[model samples]
Target chain A: MTDKDFTFTIDGASVTAQPGQTIMEAADAAGIYIPRLCDHEGLRHQGSCRVCTVKAAGRSVAACTQPAAPGLVVESETPHIQAMRKSLVEMLFHEGNHICPVCEASGNCELQAMAYRLGMVEPTKLPYLEPTRPVDASHPGIALDTNRCISCGRCIRASEDVDHKGVFGYCGRGIHRRITVNGEDLAHTDAAVSDHAISGGVCPVGCIIVKRVGFRLPIGARAFDRQIIGEAIEEKRR
Target chain B: MTAPRKARVATVSLAGCFGCHMALLDIDLRLVELLKHVEFDRSPLNDLKHFTQRCDIGIIEGGCCNEENVHVLQDFRRNCDVLIALGQCAITGGLPAMRNAIMHSDDPLRECLEEAYVLSPYVENATHVIPNDPALPLLLDKVYPCSAVVKIDHQIPGCAPSGDIIYETLVQLLAGKFEGFDPHIVHFD
Candidate 1:
């Protein structure tokens, strides 16, 4: 618990970090991937999805948001943590219409990759809730399918923070909450229709998709198809 | 005094493109090797219209979109010890189940019928009349995934699952090794 050395042991591996860095940041720097869905490196951490929950100092905290302290013992990838992450993924599936077969983001989706990483081949024990959310295809380049949205707020963060467009925002509350555009639909929003836009490629699932380019990358060639997400991230680190 | 044991497998396609069955055939020379361990019962592969006896495994390749599909799926559940939902159609209501997207609207079946038979540009003047014969199996309001209708013991997911995947899954099932299936063998698309 001493603040002298800027280092912490994560899953027994000592990872050094800066003072203000989060557990997730240190893990990323050391190539120790904490499985995450909502917390993308390019965007600010929403701490919405608790997929990156890890035991730190005997308390379960989201690694993406929890600051790393010296001598902090962080335990991730334990059977309990793995099970918790799996259940969270299951909860996401239950909440949304994530028919992975039909979803355009099946192969490349972070959620799907996470599920694969956790060895979730079958559907979760939770009852599937087939919510009939509207698919806004008014935009020429993008389609917003609310059914597959996991409410990670990545699009909300990317739109407002990164793109600085403020086109996307959260609507409703709890289970009824969803990502919404400021105007009539995506067509009327200030979305620039580029990869940099929040609604463009920031979506973890098949929620906000660029129209016509869904299957362009092909199945086997996609990011998660050839290598697991962690391997890809670690490769980037190397 | 002893009997030879072989796994009996029955397969059917409901509201699907039959691509899954094609994937099965894509096993090619391995089909001969597979036949050594398993035998086909009522399946398009065997050209059997109905099940003659109880089966060890039932491979369903489509979602239940009509009354006939329901009847057949129920029959599979009754006759088979293990029912495996194969492909996207069987597991998650593939392309055909896109019709269920209209579930939000009232009289979605009617809307779907009109859109398909009458309103679609593909339909011509003479052929535009909606088929409502008593002989035809009635279409369900929404296409249901196989798991929604019956207990699916194992699911092989894909638009049309790769032959290698099907072969691997079948081999695993045949070997009584249910757990630890290769993740690469089950891509969604």
Candidate 2:
């Protein structure tokens, strides 16, 4: 809206951004969704999941962390970029024990929704890791299933920034990387069901679940059942 | 002129619950129309236990959790020109693959068998015997998706992909369209 704002083109459409705004922020404002996993609204962006990888001025960059520059052209939905995003999503599926049929977050999970959006009917390319992760149900009102965690750091951010509990953090590295509680398990920490990190949908996927209220909604009525992810943002263009 | 030879289709439920086959039956009246174009070769719909000849399409409805499932899937891959992994089990190992997470210890299969036959609270096995019948298929260490055991040309992803999805996939595959289902039509659950 001003002369000082940076302007860029994403998939050939012009997008305007403020000086410090990232490519994701600009494209989002312009109603273009660069497929993302780790980056959530209001939370600090961690460019961990490369699902939001985009070709910016001929180089692949994480759109959520990369600052939009004047005259920069970014390609988000090209066949090659889309394939990359699909592969990333597939890797996430293969790395985790994401048995969707029995999963508590089958329909409402952003990871599952992103997989559907990426046209991943089956994750055949990568061998399933099938790692045995801990499931902490000790919390009186919450449950933590680490098998579905993508290590996006959203819960860590939300707990630290929003709830100010500093309850969640990461331990280990590479494939062994996992979310750890401040103390022993979730119950040992200051985590409560009413905490913003738990109630605010910070943990995308079924990693953090509220006890005893799962499967309340039928299959066809859950989030991302009929409406595709990012449809609401894309609707702004209309 | 004689009508074109009907497409020969075979189907099998390996480690699945046969819910997918039920969904296939859920196609309802469309099965009559589908029968006009295709003939069952080894499917349970006709109760044919063995494939007598090469099949045009083989719809597989489960992952390989045991030796029998692997053999059946490999046979399907050999006999059919096209092999489709139908439903979540076949595509991604589904509910059965939940056991794969606990396969870190030695003899994970025996651990699973013991848990089911001896340790489970619902079981009333006073003798604590795990079935070791030689006739029973030997359990694999972990459940594997159909694609891991044999080549899967296409996959339909759902707990039991709706009857409409199964019908459309069959019609499309029969018409020689291999583009696969639209993303919107595909669901994991």
| Number of the top-ranking candidate, with TM-score as the measure | 2
Residues B98-189, candidate 1, lDDT per residue (tens digit)?
66656465566788889888998877757678998899999897888888888888888777888888888889899987765676555777
lDDT of 2 by residue, A1-238 (tens): 8889978899899998999999999988888888899989999988999899999999999999999999998999999999889998998998888988888898899999998899887438678888878888999999999889999999999999999999999999987888899997888899999998998988889999999999999988998888888887898787
Give interface RMSD, per candidate. 2.7, 2.1
Q: Once model 2 is optimally superposed onto the true structure by TM-score, how far is the C-alpha of residue B131 displaced, in angstroms? A: 0.5
Model 1 chain B poorest 10 in a row by lDDT = B97-106
Residue A184 lDDT, candidate 2, scale 0-100: 79
Clashing pairs in 2: none
* For every candidate, C-alpha RMSD to the true structure in Å: 2.9, 1.4
Tens digits of per-residue lDDT, candidate 1, A1-238, equal 3555488899899898888889999899888899999898688887889999999998999999999998999999899999989889878866777777767788889988887788765733454566667888898888888888898888888888887888888889987888888999888887867746544458889888887877887767887887776875577456
Q: Estimated TM-score per prediction?
A: 0.90, 0.97
In terms of lDDT, model 2 sits at 0.88
Stretches off by above 4 angstroms in model 1 are A1-5, A99-103, A123-125, A198-200, A234-238, B1-4, B125-129
TM-score of chain A of 2: 0.97
